[model samples]
Target: MPYEEENIQQFSATSSSTSHSFLRSRIGLVIEARETAAAITSIADAEAAGVEQIWMTQSPPTLDTLTLFAAAATRTTHIRMGTSIVPTYPRHPLILAQQALTVSDIAPGRLRLGVGPSHRPTIEGVYGLQHTAPLAHLSEYVAVLRAALWEGRVNYHGNYFNVHATLPRTSRVPILISALREGAFRLAGEISDGAISWLCPVPYLLDKALPALRAGAEASKRSAPPLVAHVLVALSEDENAAQDAARKRIQYYTALPFYARMFADAGLPVAPDGTGLDALARSLVVYGNEATVVQQLTELLAQGLDELLVLLVPVQDASRELAQLARLIGGMQ
Candidate 1:
């Protein structure tokens, strides 16, 4: 079957109103830790706080994402679990599909898989893998993954992947692509269930990400899927201290090539030595007292954000701050 026909058939079998409903209902939290126990604790805290979904990133030098989610699945029952992303360079589609399905078996109706071609520094410098034609690689990778996960079989032959296998028919796990730029946003809309964004300002999302995503969805003859923004939020009475901490977090991404370009495109300053980070920091990180923070987030949602995946920036009394945020979000409903 052709690609379009295959996609329609696959989605028809698995797509339901419930999948889209889940996206609209939740205020998600992204939790990261160097240790499995700490991560599971965060998951438990999030669950207890009435957080609807929890996301984990596959940041290198940290606990593996799947392991953390699997451990988290055993520890919590109701809250949903997801990967903000697992890079495609290091893991093949077949292996990723298998691992994701295993997690689905453990967690059942509560797994969302986010996958992407990560930036060059991690893929090339850290992993020592060639970062060539990433768009092509991701396109082919999604094809193979969808074939296996959605359709339960794959006889795919593409430039980057060649696989022939059949996997057990498991529950459909929504696949979201980590999209930053235009091409990536289109790719996510074209093939994947949703798009996961990081370190992008709200204006950029409205101007760039959303438009490209809509175009891709139109091309695919599918409704536009959920667009998840992984926003950095700091709740603090000490404005200066919160801005300082938020700037430090933004600085880390400025050093990265892909994010650096994104920052520049958004007209946020990037100093030679990565100083003068206030503009980007203020735009991306929501820092204020409880009321101010809630208002800022509300304004962002008004600007066409489908979901906000909150990443809490470290600050004084972080635990108390998280609890306060939980209460605020719980009241928002």
Candidate 2:
């Protein structure tokens, strides 16, 4: 059967009770920091607006994610903070464990450490590092990182890492892995606390990710962890303007091989050079007026997402965009 047909059948097979149960799942926001001050303010504002969690991305040429989270920890009291993912390439597992523990010390139970083997282009092309055997690298890195965080010491020698060190403090910081395809998904379910995803359509997530996650968890005889969806959101009265903003926001990711493959697998028509903005936005973006966007989000949650991490796509003025997002979140309650 074609992927689209399989997606529909899977979606239809989901029980009604499960669909309704997801409505009560946690909702969060993903904020991009232009600077430290703005990021801190955004975290506070989102928390005040009753967002359950706040996630930040780790990328080069941006404000350091850990440093920003440390600052955010001091400014906010209740909201959970996480790295949507820190790539495991440049940073050693020991160093990553230390940094995560330091953040946990500052914020205590409010920190969740999310890590991933980032794309080959960024790891190899830009950083001048070898990106061979990413799955193997992630498995070893996560094993060492998990041991260090949980047991306070790691004495493992794996294919990618050979470390024997005791961490300063043991942390209960839940580790989430960025799992897009089957291998990453299983790895997350088997070991990590949860799985994090971006740019994945709802149908594909139901048909592919959820099953893979369950299989891995079952294989390990552990309960399946939360599946967090990171979605791009644009709020505006004008539908065209909202979609246009979403298109511009995500166009960069569409060019990356990882995301491009994901979009294609979801049966979205994406060209090699990045066309089909409308279809892409419809499948991946949560856009439109307040009520429309809320309905769309509720529908997405009903598809078995454990958490929805909303990444606001700035449509007009930044301040205005945030205010609009706050209002939309307010309406959801």
Candidate 3:
């Protein structure tokens, strides 16, 4: 079966109305840990600029997410706030659920918690603790977290997770998983609220992740959830420069063993200067003029994405690039 035909068949199977913050101009901002004042300001600006959500992600899992989330929440009234990706290796789900609910209390049901089994470097190198069973760990963690937050009283025991606690269900925090491969995708759909994907293109999302999400939902006989999709974005007049910048970012991802394999699996060239960074350049990241960027991104909707969190790549002229993107995206909100 052809790829497009496969997508068509999938589309026909359920025909569920996918949730989108896109047509609603459901754009958001993603900032690094290095930016405190900048992140706060960016969130405020993005909200004022018509962006719908504000996401924060960084290392140390203790970059004062509470402070940053509180500040962002206090600063904006209408925009939703979320943790772009919080690693599960360092933080306990019950504790995180408590803190996330605290913030949601302040913001009143606007908290989105994105969890993941972080990479080996961040997991072992920095935390000095290694996770032997990432997928299993995540599955149990998300299950426990969801039960604690939404249902209550979860007594779970697995090689990676063992827990017995009476959790509070005072708040409903949306749990979004940072998923990529088949196992992670299954966990997200089977257990969590939604997914947050990075460096994955439309072809893969449409053909791969969405199907897994649907299958998970179908297997459980549960309703479908949101699918927040995002990637590094830049608007440059010179297409070559755009490609180069994208290449640099892609190199950062492909250099990592985990992401490199994901690239290779996605039909990208393996590195040795042959990494799937090449495919990432042409298909994944969108860089160029307004017309070109919009076209590339719109094409991504074919992947069944729900929201587009356009992460502006780091640059000295980030503000300029952001402004241009805002315009090209036809005014953020």
Error of 3 at 287 (Å): 2.1
Q: Which stretches of candidate 2 lie over 4 Å from their true place?
A: 1-25, 330-332
**Distance (Å) between predicted and true CA of 103, model 2?**
1.1
Clashes of each: 0, 0, 8
lDDT of 3 by residue, 1-333 (tens): 011233224323243343333343445566554667877776677667666666777577446665688778888897777776888888888777777767877888677788888789878988998866888788778877776676656687767768787755556677888887766676666777777788877677777777887778667666556566776777776666767777777676677777777666677745676545565787766776667766666655534566676787634487777756654554522
TM-scores of all models? 0.90, 0.90, 0.86
Report how far residue 7 has shifted in candidate 3, in Å.
Answer: 23
Clashing residue pairs in candidate 1 (N, C-alpha, C atoms within 3 angstroms): none
How many angstroms is residue 175 displaced in model 2 relative to the true structure, after the best TM-score fit? 0.5
Clashing pairs in 2: none
- Under the 3 Å rule for N, CA and C atoms, how many clashes does model 3 have? 8
Q: What is the lDDT of residue 164 in candidate 2?
A: 92
